[model samples]
Target: MNILHFFFGVCGNATALFLFLAPTVTFKRILKNKSTQQFSGIPYVMTLLNCLLSCWYGLPFVSPNNILVATINGTGAAIETVYVLMFLMFAPRREKVKIGGLFVFVLAVFSAVVLISLLALHGHPRKLFCGFAATIFSIIMYGSPLSIMRMVIKTKSVEYMPFLLSLFVFLCGTSWFIYGLIGRDPFVAVPNGFGCGLGALQLILYFIYYDKNKKTTDDNAIEMGPEKNPHQAQDQAQAQVKRSDKGSQNGRV
Candidate 1:
């Protein structure tokens, strides 16, 4: 085996580990609230779809001697499916609709892109075209967290974001980039450049919000129920306090 291959493979494996751990924050939120209202299922659903696509794309190269990509992406699809199902179980009706719409959109667009590319190109050209399209989608998918990043900056609190997950995303991106470079997979490597950039920004924002000396602030506080009733505000405040306490505890450890 080539030394460079070994090195890149190692890096890829390490980064994959990071990606796996990136959902801890989401899981913790579920555990803390016994619900999934604040979290969105679109990302995980998209991730599963992406994994499935990767597995499908790798089928031709899935010999016993070269099944790494197939195996990893196939496993990814399975894991993400479980996560999405769990999310659906606890999500609100509106959120569920959002996820469902996103799922359909992803399926439609992904299918169309694959079909068009397959029909329009062949050999190395097909690979490049597919890779380019995949990179564009991956960049958009990974950049989906920017809104949350902005929320963090606005609130000066990492309440909705978590540090470890951000770190994992960054590491995952770096790993995939190395893996792509080593395997000569431009499609895989190119999108990860954007993923790494977004992930790093997320990490930076986390530190800015959650650092030891940084004070917590809530800028966009909104009322949850009827505003006319003074008692409603009190009740909402009490419930929010409970949720915030649990969320903070869950986040800290």
Candidate 2:
């Protein structure tokens, strides 16, 4: 049983690492294009906060030092920092100002939490406070993808939502839930339970709307076929007349 718990913990950490890094491809595109395009920096900001809180929660001051939790989330915080910097660099001035303001606000709030936890609280109280804070943030982070769900419904397309990311999130959640259950840690389990459910819903919506978007695209192409064919034929006729006229002039010459 102990071994099983350790295995699940490791798996959970691995999947969570993948989840944190999943946006690399999107950011890579943004970097290559030298624009933030349609991507928003808010989610990455929230994710960074989530990682910070999680890292704090797993620290010796807040709880037992779970190296797995600390390491992955610590790395997550670093990666998210890079992503947010890239976003700030490439995003328009208006968006950059907004994200910069939001980043400042997040930093202020996180600093307050750390100060409170370290200076005022200690031992079990500190653990409970930090644990609850982490759990709440994790739940919020899991639901961050709700915006994508709304877009999926509104556009009838899953193009904005990456399926593999959802899959990894679900897997990560499941692994953590099991690990928490076996280890008797509600703070870790509860949020992940919600995460699993939300991830599953996203996957279902993807499958449902994926085919609809494809069909709609195909129908639009078909509807435009006749409209394009006539224009194409007219252009060809004009080109043929020009060629014949040129040939006649050359013969006369």
Candidate 3:
């Protein structure tokens, strides 16, 4: 292999490893808070869908040359499916429904399109269709991180956005981009380019909000405990509830 191929392969391998490790933070949160509220399965669901689609796309390339790609993406699909299943078992009813819907949608629409096109097309046409479809799907998958980034900026809290996860995404995006370039696959490289940019933005937002909230939380600790003054806390909460109700009424009016 040439230097370019070696570099891209190493980078892609590293990025995939990072993707594999991204879930550690979620497990840590589950252990730390003893609650699953901090965990969201949407990202994992989307990732699993992406992996499965890639695996399906790589099926036509059974030239002994693309087996590595198929194996990695197939493993990713299985692992992601396991993660989603675990989340479904543990998550709230509402979240479980959402994940289920996403799973069905991906399985139905995406699988059908790829299957139909693969069977319908022939020879070089098959390669072209699969490559094109994979490229589009990859771009959409890479864009999934934007929602988390938006949530972080809106809340000004990285509570739902783990720094390590974002860092891995950044690394993953970079590695895949290089992999695509080396493999001469425009479908992979183009999307990962945008993915790398978004990943960096998420990491920067993490640092900005992490320290900003730390001081506020520490400052609040010195004040009266909502736990110690239950009545006061209840009244305060009720007042906020009333205020919210009034705001909603006014909006309706």
lDDT for model 2, please: 0.75
Candidate 3 residue spans exceeding 4 A from truth: 1-3, 24-35, 59-66, 154-159, 207-253
- Could you give candidate 1's per-residue lDDT for residues 1-253 as a string of tens digits? 3566556555655666456445655565676787774445667777766676665455552211224555666777777777777777777788888877877776787688678756776665665555565566667667766766655565456655556556767887777776677667767777777778887987778766675754332322111111112334345445766897999999999
Give candidate 2's total backbone clashes: 0
- Cα deviation in Å at residue 139, candidate 2? 1.1
Clashes of each: 0, 0, 0
Please report how far candidate 3 places residue 188 from its true position, in Å. 1.1
Q: Which tens-of-lDDT digit does each residue in 177-203 have in candidate 3?
A: 776777776766787788788778877
Candidate number of the best TM-score: 2
Q: Give, for candidate 1, the lowest lDDT window spanning 10 residues.
A: 219-228
TM-score of each: 0.68, 0.80, 0.70
lDDT leaderboard ranking: 2, 3, 1
Tens-digit lDDT track for model 2 on 1-253?
A: 8898889889988998877766776776778899887567887888888889888888865777355677778998998899889989999999999999989987887798899998999899998988898898899888877765665676555554566776787898899888878878888889989998887987798678765424322211111001122334345545655897899999999
Whole-model lDDT for model 1 versus the true structure? 0.62
113, model 3: CA deviation in Å?
A: 3.7
